[model samples]
Target: MGDRKDVRPGVGAPAAEPGRVAYDHHWARDLHSSIRCSAAFLALLFAIDWGTGDLTWWRSALWLTLALLLFLVLCPPRVCAGEGWMASRALLRSRRVRTDLLVSVRTLDGVAQLLVLRDAVGGRVEIDPRVLVNNPDLWYRLDEDARKSAASGCLRSGTDTLRHFSERLERETALTVFRISGLDS
Candidate 1:
């Protein structure tokens, strides 16, 4: 498949009108705020101790603050929110759907998330296929496809309309399909 450009689905098909794709700023803001807040808090605590000339406070708070920062950095409140923005916009812009693909899978709260990148030029975007609709069978099917493709090493990723819609469908029906959260349509 890697040897053939036509291996991508809808290879010869005309591109569809682009969909309205936007990054979840709340997700990004939340991440940035968290990091900022953490750094501010640490600095404040350090100043408090230093000003008071309390070596004991510094020793205790330093370790505690460091530990908390470590935890925050390791497991940020929002998952891919940060990484998506971190991806290169220039690189993503050059990649059109069916021409270049992007895909990622991550498990959260025991639930596996299949994020299929739909567009990255304007901004990084990934649809959690599980969020589509409430069809457990379909979700399973997509999951199976991903797994099998991974196994065979023929997995292709893309940022385009088809991938966007597919992911949207999955996210919308996630709850109904998986008996989980009721998606916000």
Candidate 2:
């Protein structure tokens, strides 16, 4: 109902604690595009069903099911941040970890680069690299947390992987700078 919000740490909303923050797809225009696509599919189907001058129970059921499933699967999670902990929230579940306890950050090969983050306490999360590339502020928050983790004893390994991540970030940053300054094609 109106009392319940789709994502727990919704949008630009702050967390329960004063210093915490949350990020979700609400910030992206993709949310509207997704809804439009689903609606368009059902509308198209409805027009066809009406034009045929025939109505069937199965046809209605199929369209309803299709809309529900698309929204369910495409729904994005909210990434929440605290002083040392970060959490990802979905409609049905949530995952959290102590950012200061980070142990490794490696890129897994897939359709695109998948960054996997692991902590000393066995907390792990795999997310798209585009997430960071798209949101520099989010990347800054994570980078600060990782520095704290490295300073503490909780982070014991994965320097190489961390280095690679920073290198890539730096390369992208430099490219962005050049592009903005009209120095690069």
Candidate 3:
């Protein structure tokens, strides 16, 4: 037992593809939440119409359409990162950026924080920072490529931002490990 090697994969481990890895760990949960929210809204509207005796076929159809719109608004994009690229796909469009060729990174402050990355190739992607916080594998791929960008003098801005973000990620990961090992107390 002492001589046995651990088979668990690490950050540097090769995925099925040589250096390609996609992160969608939270996609299913996000999709389910979107569906639940839309269904609940539709059910509430129908209940109110039925209770008031104002339900009609046209009204039902309108409610369904509204519910679908709500789902579209609530749905989160699927994010994936490979060796040199990251992509976010929504219902209508997909955005991708070359991580290794990144020229700029911008953080937009709003109700939800957005991280915008633009590459030398004119490809750009805007993603929620929480996605990186939740997915270490995705973060690792991006970080590895970003270092390359910096070393190659392609990255012109957001070096401090990436550094701070990486520190935060490290702290979060350490805390999670402590919590899991029952040593957080």
Candidate 4:
């Protein structure tokens, strides 16, 4: 990761690029966490079964199947900067302060989503497994107000947060937004 991109409030000064804003690998971290949780759950079930001395074949099969299912359900998918990853990579690259274009991506759950707010009408959109790739350094360098605005936007409008982040990035460098997963959290 490069140096943190400082987010100035409304000045729109294009500061020097903070080293290099490497892509963050958050999906792997989340997948690891999911695997660990699934394993722990399976272990707990096994331990309970062993302590109770109830090793029925059906129970064993059932527990194994359940654990497998849970892992499949919880594990984050292997993702990169693929086509399905972000909705507005092009928009992110070409536009600056364009509120007319927004990006929104759906999560694996299909309910919660991460959005990139280029402006009121347009921004970056995110979807499942890909949402796990949010970059922390890119996020941290943001000005306090921008962060707050994004966080609040996340709470209010899912797509609005994209603007704060995009704005932060635009303020820092001219490089395109790169998404990576599995970097140190």
lDDT of each: 0.43, 0.73, 0.92, 0.47
- Each model's TM-score, in the order given? 0.30, 0.73, 0.87, 0.42
Candidate 4 residue spans exceeding 4 A from truth: 1-24, 82-112, 116-133, 136-161, 164-185
The residue-by-residue lDDT of candidate 1 on 6-65, one tens digit each, is 233558765555432323334555456666776676677677777998758558667567
In candidate 2, residue 141 scores what lDDT? Answer: 65
lDDT of 4 by residue, 44-129 (tens): 99999999999788998888888888887776543223211222222113322222222232223436544333334444433332
1-185 in candidate 2: lDDT tens per residue? 45753444546553454454646434357566677778888888878888997658888899879887887777666665666777766678877777778987778997767777888888877666666666666666677888888888666676677677778888998999999999997
Error of 4 at 105 (Å): 6.5
lDDT (Cα) of model 3: 0.92
Which residue pairs collide, candidate 2? Answer: none
Ranking by TM-score: 3, 2, 4, 1
Best by TM-score: 3
Off by over 4 Å in 2: 1-28, 51-55
lDDT of 4 at 90: 27
RMSD of every candidate to native, in Å, equals 12.4, 9.3, 7.8, 14.5
Candidate 3: deviation at residue 158, Å? 0.8
